[model samples]
Target: MDMFEDDTPGNAPEFTVSELSGAVKRVVEGEFAHVRVRGEIGRVSFPRSGHVYMDLKDDRSVIAGVIWKGVASRLETRPEEGLEVVVTGRLTTFPGQSKYQLVIEDMAPAGMGALMAMLEKRKQMLAAEGLFEASRKKPLPFLPEVIGVVTSPSGAVIRDILHRLRDRFPRKVLIWPVAVQGKTCAPEVARGIAGFNAMTPGGALPRPDLIIVARGGGSLEDLWGFNEEIVARAAAASEIPLISAVGHETDTTLIDFVSDRRAPTPTAAAELAVPVRGELLAWVAEQGARLTRAQTQAVETRGRWLRDLSRALPRPETLTEGPKQRLDYLSDRLPNALRGLAQRRRVTLSERGALRPALLRGRLAEEGRRLEALSARLRPALDRAVTAKREALGYRSDRLSLRPISRDLARQKGDLAETLARLSRAGEADLRRRRDRLGAAERMRETLGYKATLRRGYVLVHDGEGQLLRSRDAAAAASGLRLEFADGNLELGEMPARPVEEGGDPAASKAPTPQKPAAKAPRKPAKDEPPSGQGSLF
Candidate 1:
């Protein structure tokens, strides 16, 4: 054991590895309780645990540092490799590794030069990632129903925005309170943008159509929160058009590079959100007046052209003047023309006469003799025809008689009566047969009824409501029972107790104690007959 031992230092107390590390940790933390280290970051790492681990180094010396999950999330700026930062924290030891490191509580860019350099580096990275692409930016709403402003609620920025909006066109504004320039500013601003986007559009708290991220003018360090990568990404990803108004006109941040629009100040953002109501109304009135004048002139022009076209047409009476003159001339010459024509026709008839007076008398006498001869011949023929017709009529009258007709009618009447009598007998027999069948069916139905079963010593037990109690348990549970027999129905006031077994006392087993069934309202009788027009039961 002596050979394995090392030379001991003088006046030194023994300590385990944990004990030594703990002592060194206490000493370093006591000496540098609050320190500000200025160095460029190296080998930065962010784990899924949300803790940030990095190396703070200058020319030759390097110290390991860590910002825990809580501090990391609230930090306005992230630790980046090669970025110069001023860290405020206390020195502490890692006992597990027997080494010392800084437990950083706060972190920021070292100076204005470092901040601008960090901003330019971040801008280049985001630009390369297409976050600043013009195509991704949404167009601003011409007039938003609700405008959301993300800024400090107590700050002058919100008041300025509200005043500007009211002066132009009044709109509902949703103010998301946030710290504008601190460790929590970036996270709060990012969350505010996301919260507005997450709201349901037509809900009780209406979603804003346009979002304005605003803050009062401040130095570059005060405005550094808006330059955070998280805030820039949130602004770029907003579905609602976002306007960035973080500082004065000369001031710009990473958010302005990615936002849909950029305003110089909060008031300017409000102006961009809406237009003057009075000016809009004036423009609309002017357009309406111009449309009215154009319509009136068009109608008047059409009327004047129609009036000019009508001047070329002639008068109505002139169209019929020639026809009336021809009618008058024809009326004047009609009677004289008719008289002349009649005189010419009479002369023509006298010149062309076929017979003289003597010849005419001879032809008349000859025609009279011819007519008399025809009359003399026709009279004899007519008399003979009359005699033959008389004979034919007498013979026909003798041949036709009423006796045959009367005989035929009498025979038909007798046959009809016999047929009617046969039909009556057949109808009566059919009715009797049907009556016998129906009677047999009625007797069979009665034989097959429940009363027959009762007569054979099977009693039907029914509950108070007339439903059959088919089991012993059911009968025992019932309040009252009806015993239906062939003779009559008997009602019991109460359900009987369970009967004893054969091996029990003979007296208790002898009979079920008679239960006085409780009085119950009687149920209506059920229908017995089937519906009409059904097929024969048989």
Candidate 2:
């Protein structure tokens, strides 16, 4: 063989890590499909995930066991360290860890011996806690008016109890049906006991006076539910007196130790709950007869004693004779006492009548003096009242706030300023409007007046008194003629009226002849002169 022979690739088979692990898992699970493992529990773990993990081991070999969350809660007996248990489940492998484990579907104590050992151990633990103390037990009622029974309704235990109770004394019974075996038994029984105690007294449903937790005879394994810690504590904590009749005389449970009374059987528990009705009625009748006889004897004894005491006492007539004589003595003196009282009252009335007028005058004078004194005090009192009122007014004034008045003043000031500004603006606007109207009227007057003609090389003739001279006759008859031009006025000397003969031309004769004529000068025209060379309208 060549040395490189081992280096050559060979065609054995192709396999992945996951495929190999899966094949191994299938083989292990198929071979041990369902198994019952018997071993002592070594380690117990209850993680927050609710699944239970434990180690089941023999002397040498150990196996990891897992109870899923769902199955863990339904289990009757929870796994504990050092407890021998038989677990029923299938074998499975975890590919991630590459190890095999048992998935526990059901679990129980390995045998009767294992159950007894666990029970004894639990018993000792509870006994150390004072739960089994006699002081914790309550006294059973003499004859409970209402009885609460906790048991399976379909079971023979409840029927036997009812029959026994009826034969003895019929009572109102409240039945709280509960599971009596398996995983549900412990919690249901605990709840039943607690429920009976939680009822309200004198309510629509009367609260039971006593509670009886009963079950039919069974093996220790079957009755193990009563031995649970919850059932035992519920029995110890019951407020109502409880009678435990869980099994036959030979059977014992944790409840037997904590309950107030224990009966050998359910029927015996019923007997303990109530008294026999016929016996009770007969006893009551016998007590009544005895009481009646005692009452009659007592009456006769007291009557004889009263008779003996009567013989030693005085007679009735003798007792009244002394009182009658005393009453006659008192009646004879009453009229004399009344007459003496009337005489004293008459003497006192005469003395009071003699002094009536003087007493009235003295009273009037005293009253006048008192009135004057009161008047003297009244003015000062009034003055003091006024002074107090003024001080109070001053104090209140000091406490008054000025901010509101200041704010009002500021607001009024602002309003006044706004009004003044509005008035000023209104006055300015009115003045501007009036000025515009006035300017319009002035322009119109200039356009329609004689001064417009005077500006265009024409003049106006007026008399010295400032009246217009329309014709030459008026000018000649005036003392003086004034030539008015656009720029200024020039005065002419007095004009002589020429004589007009009746036939000569009157127009020529009316022409003026002034002693001294005013020389006219051409005045410069205004800036707004008409177009050059335009003839004057005059």
Question: How many clashes show up per model?
Answer: 6, 0
Could you tell me every candidate's TM-score relative to the true structure?
Answer: 0.53, 0.53
**Total residue pair clashes for candidate 1:** 6
Candidate 1 lDDT for residue 270: 90
lDDT (Cα, tens digit) per residue for candidate 1, span 270-333: 9999999989899899999999999988866765564454344344344334544554465455
Compared with the true structure, the alpha-carbon lDDT of candidate 2 equals: 0.83
Cα displacement (angstroms), candidate 1, residue 265, comes to 1.7
Model 1 alpha-carbon miss at residue 283, Å: 0.6
Clashing pairs in 2: none
lDDT of 2 by residue, 1-538 (tens): 5332445568345568998888889889999999998999999999999999999999999999999999999999978788899999999999999999999999989988888888888888899999888888899999899999999999999999999998999999999999999889999999999999999999899999999999999988789999998999999889999999989999999999999999999999999999999999999999999999999899767755655565665555555456556655755654565556555655665667756866655665565556556656765775576567556655654445344446755876899999999999999999999999999999998987666778888877766565676676787688767676777767775666664565789787665554454545334345445323333344
What candidate 2 gets wrong by more than 4 Å, as runs, is 1-33, 93-100, 314-538
Q: Check candidate 1 and list the clashing pairs.
A: 492-517, 493-516, 493-517, 493-518, 494-516, 494-517
Best by lDDT: 2
